[model samples]
Target: MIEIKEITAEETYPLRHEVMYPNHPFEYIKLPKDQEGKHFAVVNNAKNVTVVSLFFENDNAQFRKLATLESEQGKGYASKLLDFIIAYAKTKNAKKLWCNARVNKTNYYKKFGLKETHKTYTEAGIDFIILEMDLI
Candidate 1:
């Protein structure tokens, strides 16, 4: 069995660092505004957090640092977590939901109706593109 629940920002750091920035210093995965965002995690039967994501709300909601353990990939954990986040955003009356998706993962995000925007940038040598889903 698996469960998804709200978690502290610190709880997300492990998976974020392990899966998203393994080669960089652990601090590389720490977001400056982590305290201001809502964090969540997907825990497996054994109570291990296999996936994590962070969200910030303003006029629109933006999710960041979505990561899943390498061993947990292809199992649909991230997809479920994303679906939850989208619904959560709507509950907050957000006009949109967006993310700075890694360029290589845009196709994966597109599966959930997130559209690629013209904005693009490089951070830590990885190319990223803005993807957004209209919520209103």
Candidate 2:
């Protein structure tokens, strides 16, 4: 079975580094969420898991460093975790959600009611588009 909850400090920060700065290792940018933000994990009975940090302020939330082991990719873990994030954000009274969606994942985010913001851009050598959803 899989579960979702706040990301702990132990492994998430490093994993976010790997996700955002995979090529070079350097300084870690500290954020308030690092020690107090929410996270969701999908784990099996054997204890293998995938975790992601949740970021938010006011009526907005961003899903970042959504890392899953290569072995677990294509298993719908991201979507499941995203489902949890949206629900939690709603409970927190969030009115919007933003994601720097990889160009390839735009369609996926669109399925969740996100619309392209005419903000196509590239970052970290990955083609991306900014997507936003009106959650309220």
Candidate 3:
């Protein structure tokens, strides 16, 4: 069985390091605002965090470091986690939820009502585009 729940920033480091910044030093996965952000994990029967995301800000929430384990990809864990964060953000009265999405994942974000903006940036040789969903 899979379950979604709030998690600590410390708990997020492992997956974020493994999936998102595997090529870089593990310390590079630590975001500066981690302590001020809300972290979430999608766990399975083994209690392993299959997916992770971090939300920050008041009126505008940004989704950061959303990653799923390689073995867990295509199993819908990401979709489920995104669904949970959207609802959670709504409850917090967030007018927008956005992210700097990896270019290849733009379509996945669009499935959750996120639209890409003209802005783009590069990180660690990977291209990313800003995508936002108006929650109001």
Worst lDDT run of 10 residues, candidate 2, spans: 24-33
Question: Candidate 1, residues 23-133: lDDT per residue as tens digits?
Answer: 999998988888888988888975545555556566788999898888788888899999999999888888899999999999999999999999999999999999999
Sorted by TM-score (best first), the order is 3, 1, 2
For candidate 2, write residues 86-133 as lDDT tens digits: 888898888998878889878988888888998888765779888999
TM-score of each: 0.94, 0.80, 0.95
Using lDDT as the measure, the top candidate is: 3
TM-score winner between candidates 1 and 2: 1
For all candidates in order, the CA lDDT equals 0.86, 0.72, 0.87
TM-score of 2: 0.80
In model 2, pairs of residues that clash are 5-39, 5-40, 6-39, 7-39
Cα-lDDT of candidate 3: 0.87
Give candidate 1's whole-model lDDT.
0.86
Off by over 4 Å in 3: none
